[model samples]
Target chain A: MLKKLLEFLILWIIWTLLTWSLALPDILAGVVVSAIAVLLFSDLFPAEIGRLLHPRRLFWGLVYLPVFFWQVVKSNFDVAYRVFHPTMPIRPGIVKVRTSLRSEIARTFLANSITLTPGTLTVDCVDDHLYIHWINIISEDPEEETRLIVEKFEKYLRKIFD
Target chain B: MSNLVIIFLSIGLFFNFAGCLGLIRFPDIYNRLQASTKCVTLGTIFILLAVVIHFGWNSISLKAILCVVFILLTSPTAAHAIARGSHRAGFPLWEGSIMDRYREDQEGETESAN
Candidate 1:
């Protein structure tokens, strides 16, 4: 019941912001639409909301953003350099790296981070391991690969989502 | 302020162009996705950041920020879905590829499932 209410509230808030208006008709329509959405798709919502608003998680999330952006900028340059080089140097491959995150949300977040960072793109996630397609196969060791790709993001995500 | 916006816009356009170049030059689907996802996503975010800066404190800037958040959330997931689907559909990696751990893992799974 609380989950449904939360979902409805969130949807209504988003609708209100998107519309950027506070007329009575808009508010009433938002309420009606959000309620219907919650009723129809409550099952798709996450089961746990207990830690979603925790203070520590919020703090870590704030810290994670700058770190994520810095990495994105650096990697964008790296990729751009590769794109323009006289000889396109790349040794692409699918290698597996294991994640310590237990929550599905955290794992998905990690995969997305990997996809955006450096030369790695997540091909699949099987159980605890993520198969990443790396453009430059630098290290053959699985542990090293995991550290290079997953370490920086996973630690913060572990605090935020796990 | 306008100068800053132009700088961001140019950076975004350059990356977007690079991403397209990669898409055309890359050997296979997975590699193309890697290039397009990373470069294009950052490119779009930078472009949206310019929009926010240009609009200042207004509803348009707020919407631009919201678009950035949405792109950050959805772009990689879309790429991941395509890569996973292509691999499952037996899309081959480049001939010069180094390894195939996903296929190996799949074989291992079937052996255990049996």
Candidate 2:
């Protein structure tokens, strides 16, 4: 409990710094208010007692981030080409794909990862299957398209978080 | 200006650029969201640290505190809503995925329904 409270203070202070404000006494008061809010949130939301911490897999996780970065750089042009071309060669549709990451956090991350980019969006995730909408799926094969996105993310997430 | 703070700020700016780059580069909505959220969250935290140092009072300090507070509160919520919204639209997970627990549960429920 004490540790959680300390985290609350640390979190509040971080918030105070973010805005670059100068109000002293008020900010202090705000911290208490925010702390209370966090406390209430904890009370309201019962956390599942599970092995929340994943075992150390630091090397792959760290390596994976750069891999993700490269994909982001490469994909930007692919998307831009489709969007800006005088005669847009676009093949947009919804496709279903599967993933290896079963943990909710990894799955959620994978889902969010897809949505963050330009042309494709994760339409639905029921269990392990993810439905994605591509503004331009380059190949006609849904399997290939889903493989491209999932393999990149899941491989890293499995290493990083699970 | 503190050298440490300057370093953090420079790194934060780099993250900001990276996040925007992800927004531009990724092939779909979900991937872009991942890059922006992770990068911006990290960048904003660093930027906030610089601000906290620049201001030492209570009230403004409080607002800075509030900024972080609100960010923590909203970021995941916003992301969750977007993901669920997309999922309902019928997007699929990638291939080589080994599980579909949700499908099993849903199927179980529907079978029981019958």
Pick the DockQ winner: 1
The local distance difference test score of each candidate is 0.89, 0.60
Regions of model 2 farther than 4 Å from truth: A1-10, A19-27, A40-55, A139-142, B1-114
Residues A1-162, candidate 1: write the lDDT tens digits: 888888899899888888899999999999999999999999977776667789999999999999999988887887887788778788999998989999988888899999999899988887788899999999989999989999999999999998
Kindly list the per-residue Cα lDDT of model 2 for residues A88-154, writing each as its tens digit: 4555555567787867767776776665444555656666677665555566565786677778677
| Per-residue accuracy of model 2 over B3-112 as CA lDDT, tens digit each | 87788688667766766775776555555555556556556766776677667666565666677656644664476567556544655533423333334444234434
Overall local distance difference test of candidate 2: 0.60
Clashing pairs in 1: none
In model 2, state the lDDT of residue B67. 72
By summed lDDT, the worst window of 10 consecutive residues in model 2 chain B runs over: B93-102
TM-scores of the candidates are 0.93, 0.55
Q: Individual DockQ of the candidates?
A: 0.68, 0.11
Candidate 2 docks at the CAPRI level of incorrect
Comparing chain B with the reference, what is the TM-score for each candidate? 0.93, 0.73
DockQ of 1: 0.68
